[model samples]
Target: MVFGKVIVSLVSLLLLVGVVFGVVAAVRSRGGSDNKNDSVSSSMKSVTAICQPTEFRDACIKSLGPIAKNASATPKDYMLAAIQTTTEELKKSLEVAAKHNVNRETDPINHDGLEGCKELLKYAVEDLESAISMVSGSQVKDINDRVRELLNWLTAVYAYQSQCLDGLDKPEYKTPIQDGMVNATQLTSNALTLISGFADIFKSLNISVPDLKDLKPSTSRKLLEVNEMGHDNYPIWFPAADRKLLAAQSAGRVRPNAVVAKDGSGQYKTIAAALAAYPKNHKGRFIIYVKVGIYDEYITVTKNQVDVFIYGDGAGKTIITGQKNFAIMKIGTMQTATFAAVGKGFIAKSMTFRNTAGPEGHQAVALRIQSDMSAIFDCSIEGYQDTLYYQTYRQFYRNCVISGTVDFIFGSGTALIQNSLIIVRRPGKDQKFTAITADGKEKSNGINGVVLQNCKIVADRELFPVRFQIETYLGRPWKPLATTVVMQSELADFIRPEGYLQWDKVNRHENTCTYQEFANRGPGARTNRRVRWKNFKVLSPQEAQKYTAGRFLDGHLWLKYTGAPFTLGL
Candidate 1:
């Protein structure tokens, strides 16, 4: 009996040893395969790092570090996350731009649609460049495949328009059904081109790329939908719909509160009238509540108008309109604007500033802000050329709609747009639609930049195809290392896939410009094929969040009194 028991124990021990040896052998085999995969992923990572813009390299590192850990301990997983995040961001930007333009829903030419288109393309190209270079050993792709697809998609969308323009005919519609067919063709072509690019890039990197064509057509459509309306990013400070609730005081122009437009002696018809009466270099916050009316006048809040708050009944109710073109005015490139604000800490709410310069013109800036710690909320700016200018310093716009025909939002300032609307109008018969932002002159100390978040974009003229030329940019590296970020936004099909434009003769595409995006979605947001990665990219989610108003825009100081919700998302 003792010998039999001992034999049973020995057999059990032997069985345990065999199982352990088998497990060790399996682990070793898996380790070898994992090392090979890591090698490829690591190579891809180095390439992507090399392609990233120098100024934004730190942002890229910061963004990718955590994602790498979360992605199965493989560099490929992290790279894929980066690519996906970038594609989503560009899509969001385009969607915001498209929605903003559609809200006005007028002809692209009449509504400054051309300028809007230009700006969209500019930023699109900038983002495409980044997406194109994003690579992964798992996917085995280079930046070229994405870039080619992006270019083809953009070309397909704009090809007919280019043809129409080449034919010297104004944008027009064929039969409604025919127009739909054309749109379908453009979309189909875009998908095919993007798929080809994706496949080619994967082939180059010794990775098996998916045949996007085999995927359901709805796949791309669904992605576009997810991108356009998704609100992953926080809209904590919507300057366009919020009130700047300035502390009330007994100073400046104050009379009987008035029953009607007549306030006894001189109660001031509009806030502009009151501002004109106020003494220069006045201390404290000056409140100017404008009554509801379309005031057709040009305003200049000079440096003397410091620490003043201008409020109105509502932004749409108090409309300011003017008909002026920088070309006709013969102002120099730097000085070509309609309204110039050079004051410090200026605040405005519930106002509509318009420059009614038609497409046959040059720069016509509607509102040029050049102040430090300035905020504009719940406002509507309309113009043909330079519409909302960031002359200098830092400024924030929330819940506002900006419409223009040319480079509408441009300049050198630390500007941020949250939950706002941007419209791009079709340019003149011979021109293009360049819209959104035009940032020049990079600066240290967070002085010169622009960021757009949770916004909608739209374009006029359904069949109107717009080209994103070199001059149009979401934001330029005007001052070397010019920084612009669009994060977790929506983009419309109207956005060209090329993504960004360059300033005429500006050579900062490689070294200084810092353009990045994250978590964007839309038909226009697909980055499987985009521009060269060496020149542009999709930022990691962590890097992209730094541009948020609460995180980067003075830590809620500007939004505190602006009446906007402080909704910092987790």
Candidate 2:
């Protein structure tokens, strides 16, 4: 058996080598073309990487599933993920292509090389759908077969991809190619890497859907890696921070005894300026002090700003708000929101973010956070419709009041509101909806949705009298695999005896997503007669760990800086 295994390994290695050589040949063939620039080289690298070992390629693909799961995510994100994954592959492919003088695109010989891979992906997607449909229907046969089929199709695509790379291994596509060729090759490499990552993740989902408990750490690590990548590119927090981008003071806030408001020539004038100055990759403590007035602005701290703390005098006095959303920005512009934070390990204390865009129109968004390991303490997020867009990952809100109407607290992130107030505002005569949360993508590890803890839900008088009239829901799986939970939360009768609502007819998968609760006490929390029991889980101690801050949103790595309530003793 050992000998046989060794032989198989040897054969596989040889096959891989042949694929490499094939890539070289393809590059050389491209070298002969007149457009001897970097684009050809870039294509070569991308193609070669696409054909690399399955395990590594699959790993790359795994990184992108969540990216796609984000409802707010656009095609731009898709292209970006694909292009960022395979730089080395592009370079090697281009080198070989230059040697042979072959241009992959426009060259009839190389035009259809990627076709097989695309076709394979097409089949894989179909197979995936079939598998999901079966699982949803509670059937068990052929699931494993379908998984194998998907993997097989993926393998074949890679094989052909190897051949395409070989086509570039000629003198025309060799070294000494133009700088433009090099750049193109790099870009292609990155894009494919991202695309492949998504494909791999979807493929995994196609396989036996794993439980959340079994996948937390691995998933969290991947999220952290992506967060790091974002930070490296964009320094979205702690602008005035030191070399490490961390706060200078490790143990306390910057303004207990200091009257350092805005220095005439200090590096940063406003909180935004200070945030703008922080380095993305800096670790450790970082602080930003806000003076009393309500600062009306749109704030987005990208993932790069790690370990940051923004403090203010009081939540009511120190305000940070903006009005930007699809409705306000003329739908096509896709503009909306006051603050959007994508940075991990971010903390905001004694501040308020408001969207003055009153309830006349879509009036979307106050703060949209796509961050993990973050928190808001004693802060208020006020807006009309679609107030707080919690994009993805895990976050915590302590003593925070989130007020909005019509799906105000929505998006696909896993969040906790311990000791916070959730005010569901009344819809005006002109308006027609009020939902608490919308879990965009339901796929596991995509959007855990939002969780409110030890919080009160007080609706506006207009909405108070109407029991279930408000089109509200604890959450609707935006994707087919969403999971949301609320434990020990108090809900008012305003929450409609039927606590959850459906996302139209298209996404009513019975068991595709999960919504659960524990020890939730109140008129609205009466789960026996209210809410869908099938979706609402009454957790055991062990299962409850899944809802903890550190376990759910990767808060273990960055939550220390954010003064939010976290689940301990896990």
Candidate 3:
């Protein structure tokens, strides 16, 4: 019985050994011919090929080739690696820039410039890190938006690096910083190119992409219209049955609800008193005729007083002036306005809103409009700094003159300023830069923007010497998503070659800011030397049409009511 059991055990051991050998041979065969392994290898090769067409092909290969060698590396992985390399280069340049010490009081220009570059570079790094995180998340579902946003952030990185070089204008300190910035700029540009190429590759490989469409408001909000009839359509907002009553008041055919005069000839001696006497929520339009005089009172047309029309004899003859300023009043920027209009459908014609706090007062605002569908015609807004705040909502300004020292025409409103003169005044002794039109749109989907058409950009050389006009810029972004376009405008020689100024020492508005000029004439209108910001464009004639007064402000439907003349299209 013992011999029989040993024989059975030997047979069992042989069978186990045979089974192990068979399993090892099968695993080796599968490793050589697995479909998943072959697909991964092919993908890596494809990713490596993507780097060949970029300008910095050698840098791309050196930075991304090792990652591609890994069989599991995806297109996203390769992109992440390229971004990582560029970010590292930016960090190194920032380190070099930070070593240079500058005194704000002694070397203000260079000091501010260097400090600005450091802040920009740091923001660039944070933006790249966010981009990397986006790529690692589920991107396939919204790949188009993801790719576009990624490209914007990457383009901003390249632009910031260039700006860093431009800010270090001193030759002695520039060379060292330039070398590092150049490398970072090239690397980031290559990364942008590679990522841009991915869209085409995905299309070729039959990947799904979302349809690109204009996500902004297709139509503007239409206010109540007035036909020839004396009947009202929206009685809640306009209680009166006669729409012509408001039109007659606007045309001086009917008596004004209130008259403002410096002398005791009128019921109200001050404009503020006239505004206070004006009916609130009475509907229709309350007309106030401001007589020819300089009324030195700060006025506000409150929100409850909708459809208010205030007009004067002429721009210079009837002036509303104040001296409220940042330095003197110690108030917020918005509160410093000499005249503020916060009512819907507010209209002003043939008047001057002036802030007497000269350039040294910093952000003294002359006129601030926070109303929707408002119009200002044949008027003058004059101040030293931060004049004419077109704060929020849709507005129109025509046949007017806006003059200031810095950011003379600014705000976050969707404004179409046409047939107007934008005057850049001389800066104060401590001020170095003068910028006009600081649009502050804060979102991609926002309908807020500024479109300047048939306008003249001139310097007040009469107030400032020719030498003081050396640092004037057309505009600057006050927010990351700020957008402004100048079409068919006449620019003066005082405008800087860089065209637009940086917002301040540190802000990431450069990347997301949209600035363009089309059909602009004069020495400063030359586009060859404008700052090569990624989103700044010299729009084609076809592209410029969308920004015309008719299209941009939807003026065709509403402008006639304001009695303001406007060119329908470009």
- Candidate 2 — what's its lDDT? 0.52
Q: What does candidate 1's lDDT look like per residue over 1-570, in tens digits?
A: 000010111122223323333444465566673675444343334434322432344444444455544534443444344444444444543443344322224443323433334343333334344444433321332112232223222332322222212211133322222332332233223322322333233344364433322222221212111122224222322222122222222123332222112233337764456667767555555656666776766677766777666766677887777766645543333334455666667877778887777666677777878666678888888876678877555578877888876667876666788788877776666555464666654223222467888777666552246433412334444445556777666777666566665555746454656667777766666665555646477877655656766545443434555444443321
Rank by TM-score (best first) = 3, 2, 1
Q: How many clashing pairs does model 3 include?
A: 0
User: What would the per-residue lDDT of candidate 2 be over residues 1-570, giving only the tens digit for each residue?
Assistant: 000000111122223333443555566677663464745343334334443533344444443444445655433343334433332343443443334432344453332323322332332233234323432343222122122222222222232233233323233332233232444333333332322333243343352333333432221212122232234332232233332333323434243211214534334556677777776555564567777776766676755676666777788887876655444343211136677675566777888888877776574678767555568888898887778776545578888898877767766556666777888887766765566766543223122456666778778656677746656556555555555677778877666656666666876754666677777777778777555546666776666665665555445444543445555423
What TM-score, over all chains together, does every model reach?
A: 0.52, 0.56, 0.60
List per-prediction Cα lDDT, in the order shown: 0.51, 0.52, 0.71
TM-score of 2: 0.56
Roughly what TM-score does model 3 have, to 2 decimal places? 0.60
Candidate with maximal TM-score: 3
What overall lDDT, based on C-alpha atoms, would model 3 receive against the true structure? 0.71
Candidate with top lDDT is 3
> Candidate 3 — which residues are off by over 4 angstroms?
1-242, 246-252, 467-469
Worst 10 residues of 3 by lDDT: 1-10
- Give the residue spans of candidate 2 off by over 4 A: 1-269, 279-283, 302-304, 331-334, 445-447, 465-471, 509-511, 531-534
State the weakest 10-residue window (summed lDDT) of model 1: 1-10
Better model by lDDT: candidate 1 vs candidate 3: 3
